[model samples]
Target: MQPVHIILLIVAYFSVLLFISYLTGKSANNKTFFKANNSSPWYLVAFGMIGASLSGVTFISVPGWVESQSMSYMQMVLGYIVGYAVIGLVLLPLYYRLNLTSIYTYLQDRFGNYSYKTGASFFLLSRTIGAAFRLFLVANVLQLLLFDAYGIPFWVTVSITILLIWLYTFKGGIKTIVWTDTLQTLFMLIAVGVCIYTISTEMQITNIFSYVAESELSKTFFFDDVKTGDYFWKRFLAGAFVAIVMTGLDQDMMQKNLTCKNLKDAQKNMFWFTIVLVIVNFFFLALGVLLTDYAQKNGIDAHKDQLFPIIATKGSLGLATAIFFLLGLIAAAYSSADSALTSLTTSFSIDILEIDKKKNPEEQEKTRKKIHILFSFVLIATILVFKYFIADQSVIAKIFTFAGYTYGPLLGLYAFGLFTKLQVKDKAVPFICIIAPVLTFLTNYSTIQYFNFDFEFFVLVINGVYSFLGLFLFKK
Candidate 1:
């Protein structure tokens, strides 16, 4: 409830993570950091990926999203099931068979150096922005609820946040993250469960499920409006592609899956991760339903991104609820971020710098530590930019829209690589990737201006199609 208490909660929480890092950090090298020496347990990786996948966006934004979007996010969550299948059965096998540290290396093998560098560069840009976006949202909440009361500047809060991630992850990398993510996921789920149960009890609802089911905000499908953001098919199909690109094709996500001891283990991890992710997301949207109802009945005027935090801290939810809320938010935010930093380092080292091709292991490790610090600052700067320039939209929606541009080329390149045997003009890929997102934006703008229809959730799908066509045209 108090700023001091929140600070103490964060301190105690990271203390546990730092202790885990100490244990896991021993004998750590680039291999342990990159692939966890291919020793991570499938079950641990599966459980940890839940926290990494959701991040602070879902923790705060999803619950708040219920007021405007209702339960329509479930369509995208359902689509994730389809996407994860592609990851498990298709992408995982390919990555494992190739023994890849960075999944983008597959592009070099399939295409050439130019296409490979293009894919890797796109991933670096996408994940840097994505990770920054995730941290920015959580840091804003911290500034609002805790830091502002102490007259702390927002930049200070963000710097400290990024610094903590680097401290623990700098040594053990994914090996430490596999363990820390498990703890974070546990705290995250516990927070959600606590809030759901406490809020339902406060509202005096006898059947939580029945209450959620009966609420108008609980409406999940939107088949009638084919043009709106909430349209079922549009969201479902988009959700599948989002998962495929953001997870399967992503270095930050696939890096963890690659840590598993074998292909079967990684596949099993993806399967279970999907099942739990779907169920966990439902609880988030359900929490959103309860928060919105609670806010309305109490005459609190919050909506969108502010709904969950306002209610949890200011809406008389008690000290226990507040404590867990901060923990959950921090857990969710850092779980993904720590891995993002590591994967960025991994991708850059392997894909961009070709550190692996060199003979000196010690030199490679030194280079990685410097890159780790470099990205830590990069995240800090990006968050500062978001604070100044980002609009008042729900943060999750912002992430997906941004991904439509950043990850879309990745989807097209991978699809072109895997499905078609056509040899690509590798030199044109960097240029084609740039044009795909630009074409996507123009098409989306034209549709809205001329026909009053927007791409909404279909942004990635449209961009990917554009990218595929672009690649097809330039094929050798």
Candidate 2:
């Protein structure tokens, strides 16, 4: 596709999105923006969540990972099933019974003001940085495929994308997000479906199942010893814990789950969402196997992450191939990016600064708009900074590795609050949270450097232990 064509296609896509935004905003107000008046259909929230949870990173990076990483993610993802169940059974009821607009409010009721602020602040710090990183990954892909063709600067690319999200969300907030996310999810499904069909045809692979089963990359369920990282027990535990903490405890994710009308509906959504997620992830991993097999047979160089895009544009598949892949890529990126911005706005307005209670509707509206702009700029700037410092693929991966450390405190704080009745010293919570992750990193680094203990993805376990220890020792 030419630069002008891509620009036109994008413009048309955004125009349609803006129209939907306008429609969704018609009934929106302060309450509606914050929680959608608690009227959203449970199924919509469940369906829309697939897009938000999967994101552009999963869409683009996951398939690539399969060819290299022993298909171990499926094991971990199965663990997420148990994690979401815990969230649904335990966490969802608590949030619903309390009638929370912000989940962090639980801290104030249980611990103290300082605890509330500490938990909320940890969310803000981790979420702000994490949101920026997710957007940065999406922006990098957009820059490569779309912006670079026009000689547009990276910041401009980020600005335009963020501005589109802000414009749609400033008024409607969560109300608008539900409908927009559903639409994005639909687009994502269609794009993936189309791409899959196209690849199957181009490769002339009559039996995809046999291809996957016989392929060298088909190590789906790991039942090996726990001593290995990708072993069944480790991946399963990691998957479940990662999901509970990363998705269940994450404001960015739970914000959407909380929009359901009731706890039962939310639970239903969670169960259904899990089933769908398992199947969808399986499909994507299968696609990865196919991509690997096709590339090997054809003597392609096979860059792990870039394999899908390269296969999508191979000459035999023609112009529609590029169009479908671009559309899929856009859908994947925008589905997550738009929701991330909305959650940031939601969390900031309700949690961090408490902009929701300033007692002036007009001023609250004004504050919402200003913060949206502030975060929009922040997302853009982070993308530009990422581009400058970390162009190498390995470095980009490491940046994500570093960002993964932030979620440990989230896991610890929630675990401590829910499982224990001990009254934690509120003022010390934030310090403990911060110190825990830093110490975890130091321990991991030292172990790797001196002891040569090749700690796998179990860094999550290490971080969780560190946070747990910090809370125990620093308890008042």
Candidate 3:
């Protein structure tokens, strides 16, 4: 596909998103932006959460990841099922009962102001990095495939990426995202299915699941390897904790769930979301197997993050594959990026500034708009940093490794708050959370350097344990 054709496809895609934004953004206030006035359908929220949770990183990187990881990522997917159950049964009830816009508010009520602020601050930092990582992958791909053809610099591409998200998301916030994400998720899934079919046909694989099962690369369980990252126990447990903190405790994800009309609706959403997410992730892995085999047979040197993009856009797969690939890539990328932008704005405005407490609607909206624009630029700059320093490794691996530290504190804070009734010194709480991650990092470094036994996915569990122990020491 030509660069001009890609640009036109993008323009048409965002036009639909903007039209959805226009319809949803009318009369949207902080309440609508933050919670969609608690009127979103449960099914839409369930479906939309898939796109946000998977993001562009999964779309492009997960299949590419199979070269090294194989289907062992499924261990984490299984773990996610357990994690989502905890959210549905445990966390969702608490959030609904308390009527919270920001889940960090629970930290305040349970611990103290400092603890609440610490929790929210960790989420802000963690999410900013996470969102930046996702956008970096997609933006880099966009730069390679389209922008570079027109002599556009990477910085210009990154800026345009952020600006486009800000355009439709500045007003409606979660309201607009609730609908736009559903559309994007649909496009993303369709693209995956189409690509799988096209490649499977060329390879003459009649029964995909059977063929995937028969192949050597289709190994899903890794019980024999305890020292590696893909081991079942490590990945499964990490996957569980990851789902809990990154989804249940995350403002961007839970923000959408909170838009549902009631706790029951939200619980139902989580149930369906979990089922679909597992199936979807399996498909991504299977697609990875196919893409890898196709690349090998045809002698395409592409591997890791470059595999899918190189094969999909190359002339061999046909024009339809290229068209859907772009649509799917954009849909998957923006589905998460747009929501991250809105949630960061929501958290900063409500959690940091407490703007929702003000009486004037206009003032609150004004504050939100400014913060919205601020995060848009924040994401833009962060993506540029990733391009410069962090572009070599697969994007998904970086996200999970980073999550082990950034989100580990959140897992600890929430676990401490919910399971324990004892109070700790408010000022001491912040110090504990900060020190926990630092110590966890030191421990992780030592384990890998000296012990030669890398904790890998278990780092989150280890970090959570450190925070839990720290909180216990400080309990009154």
TM-score of each: 0.99, 0.94, 0.99
Q: Which ten residues in a row have the lowest lDDT in candidate 1?
A: 223-232
Off by over 4 Å in 1: none
What overall lDDT, based on C-alpha atoms, would model 2 receive against the true structure?
A: 0.76
Q: List model 1 lDDT by residue over 235-281, tens digit each.
A: 99999999999999999999999999999989999999999999999
- Residues 126-193 of candidate 2 have per-residue lDDT tens digits of 66666666677667666777789879988888888788888788778888888888888888777777
Cα lDDT of model 3 by residue, 98-134, tens digit: 9999999999899888989999999999999999999
- Once fitted onto the true fold, the runs of candidate 2 whose alpha carbons sit more than 4 angstroms away are 222-228, 391-400
State candidate 2's TM-score.
Answer: 0.94
Per-residue error for 178 in candidate 3, Å, reads 0.3
* lDDT, residue 281, candidate 3: 99
Q: What is the lDDT of residue 218 in candidate 2?
A: 88
Ranking by lDDT: 1, 3, 2
lDDT of 3: 0.93
Worst 10 residues of 2 by lDDT: 391-400
Q: What's the distance in Å from true for residue 415, model 1? A: 0.5
